[model samples]
Target chain A: MGLHMKRWTVNPETWGAVVSILGFVLLWYILTAVLKLPRFDKLPNPVAVFSAWLSPHPQFGLSIFTRGYYLDILYSVGRVLAAFVLATVLGVGLGLLMGWSRVFFDYSFPLVETLRPIPPIAWIPLAVLVLPTAELGVIFITFIAAFFATVLNTLLGVRSIDEVYFRAASCLGSRPRDVFWNVVVPGALPAIFTGLQVAMGIAWISLVAGEMIAGQRGLGYLIYEDYSNLQFVNIVIGMATLGLLGYGSSALVRMLGRRLMAWEGRRRGGAMA
Target chain B: MSAGGALSIRQVTKVYDPEGVHVVAVDNCSLEVASGEFLVVVGPSGCGKTTLLNVIAGFEELSEGEIRLDEGPLALPGKQVGPGAERIVVFQNGALFPWKTVLENIAYGPVVQRRMAKNEAQRSARELLRQVGLEGIEESYPAELSSGVQRRVEILRALINEPRVVLLDEPFRGLDAVAKSVMHQFLLDMFERTRCTMYFITHDLDEAIFLADRVVVMTTRPARVKLELSIDLPRPRDHRVLGTERFLKLKQAALEAVHEEALKAFQAGERELA
Candidate 1:
């Protein structure tokens, strides 16, 4: 009887999440299909969107089984991955240097602070004019969006490391290089991962916007093109696909973060238990 | 190993100037620890005992006089030396790397110093863990361990370096009575095995009496060394010594010295509040 009771006691967090997602979908369906609200009139219903996604040779000239759909996904995913990786490397490197050395921080901080608050979209015209290709320009915009978030967070992370750790490292006879690798990197990791998660979100947002404005092949372009043609179902398909892809990529980043920061996870788990 | 571990502090003073207001932390603190000596400094809260420790550790600059380690000029006023492996400190809170496991934390000192290979460091870390009665939790992170276990791991992290001098800043401050007592015993045992000259600071009189061969009591801020009492307790002492007449005598003496300073600090705090 105790075992049965234990098994039945599901985690409230999990149940809450399941219920919220289902309710959201149900509400969306009701507002569009049943209530037939004026605002949601043009918005494609869940059934039309899902069926369009599954149908071979749908209005967007792509479906789940089609090569064109996969190609669009590949284009979007590839751009985001490239831009995200580039931003991570550059951001972490610059942030660590700025954090570690007062001289470096003094020199760079003014420029970074001036540039950081400017939105990535505002740089589109400048990037397009300056860069060699439109693809590079789009990637540059995506990179900028992710880069600032990562750099600022990584810098904050490094600065936030307790002074005690630095003193302890010094007493342990850690060389400058050893201190950077051992103390600065790992100490800044939690904040860096937080930065990465935020950066991933920004990366997808910028990538989609950049694609819609400039490009020809991604899910963003599909949405734009389908809207122009008044294939409303394909636009919903593109929107849903983009949402899933963004979620999946962010989840991947989160999963990697959990794996790398197992110590932090254990500490939180211990606290909860 | 204990030949040249002497630390000589001669009229060392630290002054902090915040917006042209001069606040002296350590006032002409002159003391010495001989090779293989266990010296504990006891003082009231805000007595600048930690400032003295930081000065010895080379983390803070001395405003007056100098400190010498092993008969060599270690740090002078206005030109502070950085912390070195020779004088490792075990802080009040065990500042173990939260990311690293117990074994990795212990191995950190040697690996960073390039004194031992990674595998060799890990091997010796395991041995040290066993000696400290922390055998099975080698792979545990600092947060995963109990406060007692974390303190033990921190001690090994310092000891594994086999530093010339070990400075402890209230190393067992936040533990339960049982855990604190166990740690006291564990520290004593480690001292026996490795006679690393130790400079320990604590506010707890009983802890000072239990741990120190000699205890230095400091006055309230602008702290100065008020009294130094030597303990003649037998070697291999344990919790039983806490109840001994000699131990009680030492504790009473240290407490009296500390209580006067504490009262002065309390009155000063009241004045500030007023």
Candidate 2:
């Protein structure tokens, strides 16, 4: 708690970022109001947008934000959640397999190399054509984006491990599987996290693109619909939600990583000192 | 911890990258280490001293021949390694797990071997920490300790398992003079208490003379035992031994044996460049 307080007070970066976020809001307000661009005819002013955001569905006597927007937000979150989970399972599992054995590495390398260069957005056309459902296409695109980076990062993590660790573990009477599970996995986790973080960002980008193309629901679909109808305020709201969702989810991951690798943090801090 | 096992390494030849210009590491090496003997193998760097130690520790595959403990093969034929607390190798780097505390690091051997329950391992770990003069710092991470303390922890980690034979591979490479001296004393004290057989590899002639009951000098890669001198020095030796006549004499002899090897090692490297 003291550390948090100290950080809050003394950390220029933290305060700077917060200030910049508010600055962006002010700038956004000025751009629409004071500047009064020709585009303002359809694009509602900040006050109107904020009011719309605040009361998106005022007919039911409840706040529109709390009711209608909540569902859209939930729908967006659900799609990301499903996609992220699928990406993680496929990524980590295949990554482990690729890392552990030479045969798997060789077998997967060519195919992975081919797939990785093509952006997940590029898969939208193929996914739409090949997959039966739009949701499946979105998920496939997210998975493709996440899976390759995870596998590659995991492989690199495994390769970079000190040979002595394996020798030491073996001499300590640890079995092959024990060595892999106990030493290799934990040792490689930091790098794996790097992959996961990148994969998550890519997954978000992919989901957005997929939804824009063919989505029936989700934040991306909502954004696209708002854009075509010139519902500028709603579009801004959708983008803000997406930004918050992506960043918030990533921060949660970082927190989980810290808890899981409490020891690693200590080690790194010591080494730095 | 009393004198227990005799280690006999016979015709042990280690060649790296065999089938493609194999570089011999230990050439037809044969040696007998009596139970509880503290033998230090001294040579110039690149003389395969560490390779010989690794072969004994079962971390390296010997091109030919065998290592036996108590007349039975320690490392099986056509196989690289064998079993038991007969051998434990301490690397040049302390190689402590940065993640584990001093207590946990020392407890690794017991936990790995399943010799003690987790709670029992903690108890044993505390005892080992105390023995190594790190009792108060048991909760401290390996990264938190000084180099001297870290080195002590490494020794304690190795000794925690009570291995019959312990291999020291340039164990004091990074330590300052005072830290090295402390480690020397600690090692001597542990040896006296345990009477476990030891094989220490060092490029430091003084360290070799300072600790070993016997000093085996080696030549450069395709390394062979050039000379083996019995130290017959008084036990529980102190730092004052370094100034003593007998200690200086032993140091001189160890240096002489490796003097030509040092030159040859350098020359061979130059030749490779040419």
Candidate 3:
């Protein structure tokens, strides 16, 4: 009982999420049973839903991963990785320029502001027509989705560095490049990492939307196809899988952030002030 | 320039915004630090005592006049202080870089300006740590240690450069009485051994008298030297010196010169607020 309680209790926030999810499951079950609603054949009962998730594909047997559902998951992850890497590099580079120099801010600020407010998905048709191929179009949308957020965050982080640090470095005879490389970069690192984390989430959001429109293989495409076929169980599986993958990737970014800003963690915990 | 000069400030004045609403911070402040002398400069706030030090250190360009080391015009402060012309400054807040270990803090100057081999610098760093009574705490970060230990690491950092002049800017301001007393003696002993030209600044009359060989008193902003008193007390001076007649006389004289300026500084602050 104690072991069960310990596992169930967890954090209050996590417990609330678990309870709400159970409430949703019960609500669906009651509508089908107590209300005597006409059940669609494609939409399985809760028991059937769980059974379909657990049981191996009888037709494909051991090669069940070859099914369209898993293939879509792989494609979506690949697209996300590609777009995230592109955003990280370009965002950090532009951020450094914007953060370090007034000249760069003056030259680039207006153009960035003009482009940034338009939604990444709005660029989809333009990307489709402009790019030679569909995959490139999807990648362009995802990159745009991530880049603007990353650049803005990076610029703020770089600008927030204490001016006293610069004065101190100058007093110690640090050259301009030396100041840029050693003082500014390290000082801005925690903020840059924060920007990258935000970019990753936005990259996933934009990538899936793009993939639904443009790609045949990704999880987003799989969900849309299942919905069109009236395969509600498969659609539920696809949605759940997307949630799990997004959560896992975000956790990975946060883990890397912890390692990078270990000092900040200590400061937060009252280990040092 | 006529004094047995290691550093000479010749009629140096620092003016802020000279073209518009000019405020002179330090006014024609001519001073000299003889080699191995322990000089203390004391005044109320806004006296430009720090600005005066910065000008000599080459951190600020003087509005007029010049600073010389060994009777030659010194290089600008932001230039890496030259070899054999080293000037180490201990900032008010112990300014030990939080990111570095105590050992690394001490070795920073040698690694950057002195260009000493890493192993050699580490060796000297450990030695200076011992001199500052911080042996065996070398690997700790400044934030991990107490304020007293952090200040000792800062002193070790300054000394590792083997500076001709070591500038202490209110180094004892944050310490408790026991910590300050311990630091005061440790500094005097360390200076006796190394004999660096030390210029210590404080508003505290007792601290100025306890540490300095000669005390230079200053008026409030538009600051100029009010008086210079030579400390005639014998070496290895102790807690007993605080109770002695000679020490009392010296402290009394220093306070008398600075009292009017202290009041003027307060009134000027009020006028600004009004």
Candidate 4:
């Protein structure tokens, strides 16, 4: 255990990641600032973007110092979180029902199949028209992509679970509800988590697309506004923020999955040990 | 000692129709497992022995027949009874719920069935773990354990349910010879302690002879009872008995019966493939 800790403490992986990022940043600096590449020169350099982002009182209307900047982030985050939660609930529930019952699958599968192929962005115009508010429309658009991803993944997760687990559960005196709670749910968890990660990614994509088209607020709208205004530096900031937020949300989901499925990690470790 | 219920499998027939092709899996197979008896069923691979086990476990409703636990109805041709705790089946491929810890897997039945409180389950589960010599490893997941240990845990899982009949469908099919013998001893010890009705299915003749109170030799596909042999081996038997003349005699008899069925199954395989 001590050796393991020591090896990790002086981990090469951290250095490798650091080196890669540093190398990328250096290359970016060289291209725009040093080499003066044609199109690259027009874009804000990484340093300028970082400096502008870090500045409390920046020339750009959006920056770390401004309330507007944080509000945009908060709004975008809120929309994604809300949409993700709803998608998760509906998708997982619908998926499980579809997986567990033949009747449910028969009745609702076609409806899901029809709606599933429609991209989340495709709902933007309809969501704006149908929903009372642009905010609701944007959230709905975000939800659509995530909901489908979660539903499809959750359904596949349920379907992919081995029949042996079902047999074992039944043989163990599990009632129908008991089987669902114990066998079907846990068996599908790994797959469900995979679906959640995918859904979270798509949620961000659709959220950005929806905001660009429909909304007056959020990081997505900020980027579009920056592009229209041609405050290229602010555009970089917006893009960077969206990237970090998307990565962070996916990482959070992964962390939660690991916490819940502690057994999975231990099992792998024990097998190797 | 006889907490186990008597299992009556009367005129059980199972037919599989995949893509409109009728395949008879179990043809009017009737079996009786007396209360607390260690009944081992041996036959060629794919000889409907497992189908028989599944029918008894109520995973499938028989095409034609009935099964019972003591006097309680288990499976009728047109009726779906259960895949219940009374007939816990340890599968050929281990089914110890990988998502759960070893203790959680063993404690599943009573807790899920609401028969025992959480803490009560923990205490008894610990006791079961100790019997399997897997003490202090309750927190480990199913994947962490060796296959031998996993199989042992699976048996403990069934026993913890305190089922009337424990049906094992080739529970030790993949174990090495040494591991298998160790498992056999472990199982014999468990059987002695529990005295639960054991309906063990295996293709191995030696396993049959070593474990059975009575061994039932089953015919090829659409399985039926071809021969029945009572193993009058003394209690608390171990590896030493494997070399005995009586053991050899019983082995030979079972071999002759199973060998014939195996040949027929092989020929059937050839015909199908061609």
Model 3 Cα shift for residue B225 (angstroms): 1.7
lDDT of each: 0.89, 0.79, 0.77, 0.90
Model 1 stretches with alpha carbons more than 4 Å out:
A1-17, A57-60, A271-273, B1-4
iRMSD for each candidate structure, in the order shown: 2.4, 3.1, 4.1, 1.8
Model 1, residue pairs in steric clash: none
Candidate 3 CAPRI grade: acceptable
After TM-score superposition, what is the CA distance of residue A31 in candidate 4 from its true location, in Å? Answer: 3.0
Instruction: Encode model 3's per-residue lDDT on A1-273: one tens digit a residue.
Output: 555444534888888978987897777677755565776333555665655666676231212344655677778888888888899899988988998999999999899999999998899999999999898888889999789888888898889887645554554545667568756776788888888888888888888788788866787777777668777776676676777788888889888887866545654555431
Best by TM-score: 1
The best-first sequence of candidates by TM-score reads 1, 4, 2, 3
Kindly indicate the candidate among 1 and 3 with the higher TM-score.
1
Instruction: Give residue A5's lDDT in candidate 2 (0 to 100).
Output: 42
Query: Chain B TM-score, candidate 3?
Result: 0.92
Write candidate 1's Cα lDDT for B1-274 as tens digits.
3432999999988998845888999998899998889999988877898998998898888889999988888889777789999999998887899999889999999998899999999999999888766798988888988888888889899999988899999989988889989989998888888899999988888888898889999999988889999899999898899898888888888888888999999999999999
Please state the error at residue A6 of candidate 4 in Å.
11
- For model 4 chain A, where is the 10-residue window of minimal lDDT? A1-10
Which residue pairs of candidate 4 clash? none
Number of the top candidate by lDDT? 4
lDDT comparing candidate 3 with the true structure: 0.77
Which of the two, 2 or 4, has more lDDT? 4
Per-model chain B TM-scores are 0.97, 0.95, 0.92, 0.96
Question: Per-residue lDDT tens digits of candidate 4, residues B137-218?
Answer: 7888888878998999999889988888999999999899999999999999988998899999998888988999999999
Alpha-carbon error at A122 in model 2, in Å? 5.0
Q: After superposition, how far is residue B30 of candidate 3 from its true place, in Å?
A: 1.9
Q: Give the 10-residue window scoring lowest on summed lDDT in candidate 2 chain A.
A: A58-67
Write the residue-wise lDDT of candidate 2 on B2-21 in tens digits. Answer: 46478898988888888998
DockQ of 2: 0.35
